[model samples]
Target: MPVLRPLPTQGAGRLADRYGRVATDLRLSLTDRCNLRCTYCMPAEGLDWMPSAQLLSDEEVVRLVRVGVERLGITTVRLTGGEPLLRRNLEGLVAALAGLEPRPVLALTTNGIGLAGRAEGLAAAGLDRINISLDTLEDDTFARLTRRRRLADVLAGVRAARSAGLNPVKINTVLMRGVNDHEAVSLLEWAMAEGVQLRFIEQMPLDAQHAWQRQTMVAAAEIWARLDARHPLVEDPADALARGSAPAELFRVAGTTHTVGIIAAVSKPFCGSCDRVRLTADGQIRTCLFSRSETDLRSALRSGVEDAELAGIWIAAITGKQAGHGIDDPSFLQPDRPMSAIGG
Candidate 1:
């Protein structure tokens, strides 16, 4: 349980942090139990999964999101997880979120293992779009990175998402040196043929193993050079400017209308304009992904506080948000919660 700092006066009726960043995008984790053990995320044996009893119930999740949307002005809600597809009543939860007043733009970030079967149902339930994580195109490399032989299932889920009318079904790929870094060009080519959005993300230090080394990690410049070699790249100024607060930097695959995005979180940090907040599966509010401290909202919710009061707790949580993640700083330290538990 983290301490609740004093709530700063609500500025402009938004979830504003001290540095003037307002959070309208909410990443809400549905569960902490993931199916795949990605090398950069979890250990091979998997974590001691959170007891289901400790997680926020569907009803509790709805109430918290309602406070976020109605009271705090959250406009976008992204359902994330250790793996969101594992949640049994996901469709029902989606429908409930879709019914919020001034209904939010709902999305989901998944690993795409079981998404093939649920894509259509989720879209029908009001999911706006999806982002599936795919690090490599080769089955052998996929197995090496994720410790799972479900690359076929992941690809199928990408197609299923498109079939379900989730336009621009984005694929999030992490480039790790000596792992899947060689597949950058191949992965982009595959995504181009499939007509889905592809984003190359520089590996960050959110791994549960805490073995990430900057020297061993692939940088944005390396990824750009690799992809540019195969397909000449040009910056999409229009899209780049329009992508305000978006982490990815947009570039057009020259000679074609298709575009690619790169999220240089470590190399070209985007902490200055970040407008996102996260809610852990167990009901902690984190204003930053690298947050060392989180405010406990579950206790207040269980104590039977009104929605307006819950809104105050949420405000206090963001009051002390740091100026930046400071990954490049000499004093930088990884958060206690790994990416899986933190809800990327």
Candidate 2:
């Protein structure tokens, strides 16, 4: 039997692994398929998707998550996908995770189109929170960004999530300088009124689909400046101290109690505090979002690898994680794989 020991006091920080990095968050991709062709995530003619035979079964994903939580201190698991809702029987997966002795906080990131139909089922299965990707509120712009005219569907989904008790639903907007930057204030205003947390994200070149150009990228500081001019803002006391692993710079409107966030992934890379790992839909474990290397765990699972062997695989993958992603190099070329293929 594994002996229980007292945890050390570490200045409010989480327990770090042998690598001296805290491992508390796991992002598991359920599928490499998305219904929308967002220019930022996939090409107009999307690449061929992974075969069903290769992808990890829901059971496999849950098993891996159990090991990750037990051994790597993962207390939170966020379900992502090409669009997570696209995967069927998601509630089954959610239920399995919820059955844990001390269940981790279950959350999901989605494009929000299908959320309306699934929100109730998801919450009933023990999902705690949700993050919806809404780049623009305008129907035309929304259509342009996602190549789908489903703005109304997404909005309804947000409402459904709230109705289902997914409190403080987060809205993730990628601020493209000339494209959607103009809508920043409006988006926040809507989120504030709706009681949802809005987060403006800086565009990054993680995949080739975005057709990212330097001129189109806006910095987080600029976004803050634009928003601050309209309404006085203050740093959220909860987020004042840099936790090192958090992706968003959190702040709140001066007069309002609601909070908004900004994710500066491109201009300000938060590499030092990255304490999470990603598992693609097909079971390849990626330590970094921008990593080019991945360890194949699908084959191992299919070949009947024991829990000990699987744990060893995870250990090796974590150890191989790079100190930082080299996105600053001018010679840097975007990954050939589309975000959908890699489980964005």
Model 2 regions lying over 4 Å from their true place: 1-19, 242-244
Report clash pairs, candidate 2: none
User: Model 1, 28-74: lDDT tens per residue?
Assistant: 99998899999899899998888988899999999999999988999
Please tell me which predicted candidate would have the highest TM-score against the true structure.
1
Q: Write the per-residue lDDT of candidate 2 for residues 1-344, one digit (tens) a residue.
A: 12223233321223343345666788889988888888777777776888898888888888888877766567899999888887878999899999875579998999898889899999999999899999998999989988889999999999999999998899989887667889988998999888899998888886555577766688898999999999777996667786457898889899878788988877787776777888899898887777778889888988898877887777767766655666776766666556676654
For candidate 1, the 10 contiguous residues with the lowest summed lDDT are 1-10
lDDT of 1 at 333: 91
